[model samples]
Target chain A: MKVNELVQKLELEVLCEGESFFSDIDGCFAGDLLSLAMSNVRAGNVWITVQTNMNILGIASLTEASCTIVANGMNIPDAVIEKAKDENICLLRSEKGMYELCLSVGELI
Target chain B: MNSFKVQYTIDGEDFSVAGEASRKLKKVLQSLGVDPQIIRKATVAMYEGEINMVIHADGGVIDAEITPEKIHLFLRDKGPGIPDIALAMTEGFSTASDNVRELGFGAGMGLPNMEKYTDYMNIITEIGVGTTIEMIVNTSLS
Candidate 1:
């Protein structure tokens, strides 16, 4: 599934678009532990997490996760959003919790 | 590939700039057209190491030695040297403050993750002095 379709279907809030509009979503991974997530999230996975720090962008870019969906509507810092833009990693936000977000992603991708 | 060393001075304990070292190195590798998987491995190792520097050592220096065959990374920190290297290597063990955990790291996976991603790894430290980690990722390995 492409990211734009999922964004519309899931009603996600796009905090930063980067260049991930049509990027393919290969799978879905949900984790908050940065190291664990680093070791686990595969390339092109739509990673869902509650981590909104700038470091999350690092993890996302390192793992090549297609997009990061910050769950529970967390307030991502401006630095993070700006870094995401600079690095071209898509950052999205959702009002749902991690579990619910995973459920929604499961249905689509 | 020409052999060269790229060094970055990690600044302060600021979480805001935690991963710049690794990120910049990743870009350099990309510019060199390094393999994507190799780049990911190198970046992950250095990113975790960079975060450790900020969280525990109050920042440090990361040097990437790029060559025809591999990339050698040197991470040096002058913080409280690790008391027990074995314990620090164990997964899920951490000495980071609560605030560090709140930033979404500090699950004690830093050193282990570095080992997992690189082809060769070594550590040198003195309790009153500092800690230095050397990791190698060979481009020809995979």
Candidate 2:
């Protein structure tokens, strides 16, 4: 499924617009640990985490993940949002917890 | 074949900027048309090294050499050296502080992951002096 479709289906907020919202989602990875996430998350997967720091963008780009969904309605910093735009990484915000987000993503993809 | 080299200095004081070097390297590799799989391996290995440098070492320097056949990375730090390389190599071993863990790292998988992704890895360290790690990912690998 494309990211925009998933965003609309889940009612996710676009924290920052990336290069494209039409990127394909291959899978979902839920974690807060950056190192573990980088080591384990598959490319083209939707990364689900509460990490709102700028480093997440680096991890997302490095892993080639489709997009990152910040769970539980956390506030992502403006600098991070700017970096996301610069890196062309789609950043999404979701009010659902990580578990619910994963379940919904699983159903969609 | 021609080669390209880049060097970066990691700041230990800031946890926010830990993976910058690896991210830059990934972009360079992508622009150079390196295989995606190979780029992933190199980026993961080097990013782990960068994290270790920030969490363990006060900071460090990374020197990367990219060539047609392989990507070589050298990570050096002047932090308290690893007292036991073997134990440190263990998957669950970590000396990072609680604060570091709060930042979403220090699971003790950094070195192992680096070794796992790279075709070759070497570590050189001294008790109170520093540590230097060299890792190579062969682009020829399929």
For model 2, residues B24-89, the per-residue Cα lDDT tens digits are 898899899998889999999999999899888889899999999999999999999999999999
DockQ of each: 0.76, 0.79
| Winner by TM-score | 2
- Model 2: clashing residue pairs? none
True contacts kept of 2: 0.82
Model 1 B-chain TM = 0.97
i-RMS values of the candidates, in order?
1.2, 1.2
Give one digit per residue, the lDDT tens place, for model 2 in A12-99: 9997758658888898899998888998788889999998877898888888888899999998899988878877888999999999
Which candidate number maximizes lDDT?
A: 2
Compared with the true structure, all predictions reach lDDT values of: 0.89, 0.90
* Span of 10 residues, lowest total lDDT, candidate 2 chain B: B98-107
Number of clashing residue pairs, candidate 2: 0
Candidate 1 residue lDDT tens string, A1-109: 8998889999999978878778899998999988889888999999999988878887887788889999999888888788888888889999999999888899888
Among all windows of 10 consecutive residues in model 1 chain B, the one with the lowest summed lDDT is B12-21
Model 2: residue A84 alpha-carbon error in angstroms: 2.0
